[model samples]
Target: MSKRDYYEVLGVSRTASDEELKKAYRRCAMKHHPDRNAGDATSEAAFKECKEAYEVLSDASKRRMYDQHGHAAFEHGMGGGAGGGAGYADMGDIFGDMFGNIFGGGGRGPRRGADIGYVMELSLEEAVRGVEKQIEIPTLDECDSCDGSGSADGKLETCGTCNGRGQVRFQRGIFSMQQGCPHCGGRGQTIENPCGKCHGQGRVEDTKSLQVKIPAGVDNGDRIRLTGEGEAGPAGSPPGDLYVEVRVREHEIFQREGDDLHCEVPIRLTQAALGAAIRVPTLGGEVELKIPAETQAGKVFRLRDKGVQSVRSRRPGDLYCRVVMETPVNLTSEQRELLQQLEATFTGEDARRHSPRSSTFMDGVKGFWDRMTSS
Candidate 1:
């Protein structure tokens, strides 16, 4: 019988991108994996078929050949049998490409430690002015007992399974494939006696306290990276980086937008009407804000260079203070009498001139009454 089309097996079009092909193959493989299916031969066969299809379709040169001349293009030196069979070298390349990310691949060299993130919560004031803080980070560090050798005797021996090749070949029908050795876990070396401390892992969990200097004007969600501060790699590889993400707590008095600071300042009705000088709090210090006569509620006052400084530019931002006029309450008899007299005097003036909004609303009410009585 003729072999099925590679795209048909993976359920992808020939024109699919490498990412799309990989996604389709991953979905199918995860669904039909032998471990997931557990003794289902049909699912295992389907999983292998999908893997083979992805191995060919994911590669540019192989895909081009298969598209141009079908499976016959690999019959000569490409190591395919009469009806499309892949060799051990091809399978090794596929496995390397797939598991390389998981195993950390830099040309089959030493693996680096995994990068980690540490979240640091800061108050609004701390974020604006910056502060030095000490953080405890739990990470994997090199074991000091066995000197990170992962062996009881601080010595390593060649793997007996793959014989230092790191991979083992297996024949499947007419195709041959190579997979990472389970014995050595692709390290190509074996520890005869595991390290008593780290159990041959070469790294141990430890909490390290590090002092971090937060830069001025770092906003919420900003990240600072410290190189070589993350977990140590196995044996002698380079350590990964540690990312410090900043989270600014909400402030009760101020709200930050970009580099600008916004705050609501409540002033008495007398202060809004007759005008008064008030002290407003800023990041730098307290500043006097002059409220002009007839200052209405919701009036915004700008204080230049009183906001947070920019992390990149180092220049300061402005602070905006919005005035909220508060109504006076708990008036004594004398105060009530004085307010009543003032209200009478103001009412004596032309209604349009004294209170335009009140005059307009009264006229509308009168018009509505007239219409209702007439109807």
Candidate 2:
């Protein structure tokens, strides 16, 4: 059987970032983990599929090659020697080490903290114009008391239980297995005197105030990355990054589609009959738009360089204005009489010339009725 698409296996888009890919992989691995679904071959196969997809997509070179060549890049020696092999001999141990945190297992290593995401809501104006915003994020930071050492004296000793290995061996019937040390929690070390502030965790939960600079022309779903602004790592390890996602609120007057902006402008019936110049709202300011004489309703006018400027290209887009003629309402008796007298002028054959679209539509309807009766 053929392998599934890597992105499909991980349930992510091709444009997914490293953080998104990691999150998706974690979700899949957690759901399909072998230990979670014991004796289920389907679940085991699914877990392996996710793992293989993650391994290829997580690597920069491998991902690029795969993108260019598809699955062929990883087969027939294209992925290079030994890469094509499905090495699942020690899958259990490998997965246990990778996802120990989720399963309450432990391992010894300088693990980077998990990345975080924040949604930033913006008005249409704010999205068009660059703005700096202050935001608060709650996460774990290095404990000040022990300076992230986890010890009151800033010293740690090798764990006697795991013998500095961070794992202990135990016999289960016919097989022997290695598991994290219960005493050390897989750190392979022990804090003789835990820090009073953070116990032995080496981190403290706190809310951090940060200023994020948003660029102009950012659309919904655009992300801005802030390096090292995520949760602090354990034992002074490297911290992760923060992703600020943008969501633009719906505008009352205008609707945005890509770089273009569209709006409906209501024009008076007199203005539609006689050419007139009217003011319309644009992102920058109000601009004059001229309507030609006898302009029909729903006529679209394009105003160049009146829309949003693209963030990537720095090129301004056009604004499309669709005109709808508004009928006169609440007229005085004298005004109504004058309008009625004016309407009498086009009562005969002149009405066809005055209302050509209505005349053509009526003609089509008559033709349809004649054909239906004849048939």
Candidate 3:
């Protein structure tokens, strides 16, 4: 039979990270566990399918091959060798080595719980100053009723199917396939009396509320890890961690580049021509910016230590204020006449001295036209 895509089997995106893949597998395994579904054959098949998918996707080399060549990469001597003969990992081995105890009766013992990821969005101000937030995540928590035993009577019996091996092997056309026991759900044990709250599974769905303290100067894409704050693992297994990823929202006034802050400061044409001491807004507060006489548009002024203090580096950065010259609008008749009189006076040497860039551009254009005409 043709196999489904590994990412599709695990119910995750193709770009899923290792942590995300683990979390997806954890959910799939718990949902289709034999203990929970008992006699359901469909869930058993799904459990095995997901297990096979995870085995390939979790391995870095195998996943790379699978991504590049699909299932052909692992086919018999397709790339170099049989994908399953030596390279393909069995379900028992997956639970035994990498997971280390996810299957209850395995020699490796139970696997640690899956890690969780959360993105926290903050405004520019909140990110710069730091903030405390209480977040609630829906996750699997240890059942309070059964104490993670999944049994009301607290009694368990060895599974008759695999005989506590947690896995069973079978022969397929010239090849052998090993998978977790369907009857016992790979736990190698059966619950005599299932817990009312969590069915046969040791964990229950619940919301976990936690207070997270964000350190100051945390930038976008920064992550804060909270130990043992993820989903609950099987009994006796250690829990995973929670990674809170920071996403800073766009600021209205300022744009941050590393530790430096940049902003546009608009000024009137008069201010640019005749110098003025103008107050510009900064993150800390407003500061006076001196615009020299005959200053051109797009002039940048750097203020030391006015940007941000990065969490990684103790040294503060500078804030650059780019000046934008604004032209006068909605001119009055008297003001227009006064400007015309000033324009009439700006001729010959005066125009060249005052409008040096404009004079140079005009001279360049005149020379280009002269060359074209001469040619």
As for TM-score, the candidate ahead, 1 or 3, is 3
- Where does candidate 1 have its weakest 10-residue lDDT segment? 76-85
* Candidate 1 ranges beyond 4 A from true positions: 1-107, 161-182, 357-375
After TM-score superposition, the amount by which residue 190's alpha carbon in candidate 1 deviates from its true location, in angstroms, is 2.1
Candidate number achieving the greatest lDDT relative to the actual structure: 2
Q: For each of the candidates, give the backbone clash count.
A: 0, 0, 4
Candidate 2 per-residue lDDT over residues 32-112, each given as its tens digit: 866578788999899878977976787554576579777765452222122222343254455556644543335344456
The most accurate candidate by TM-score is 3
Off by over 4 Å in 3: 1-107, 156-192, 371-375
TM-score, model 2 to reference: 0.67
Q: After the best TM-score superposition of candidate 3, give how far the Cα of residue 355 lies from its true spot, in angstroms.
A: 0.9
- The superposed Cα distance between candidate 2 and the true structure at residue 209, in angstroms, equals 0.8
- How much is the lDDT of residue 61 in candidate 1? 46
Tens digits of per-residue lDDT for model 1, 221-308: 8999999999887654578899999999899999999999999999997788789999999887888999998787899999999989
Clashes of 1: 0
- Indicate the TM-score of model 1: 0.66
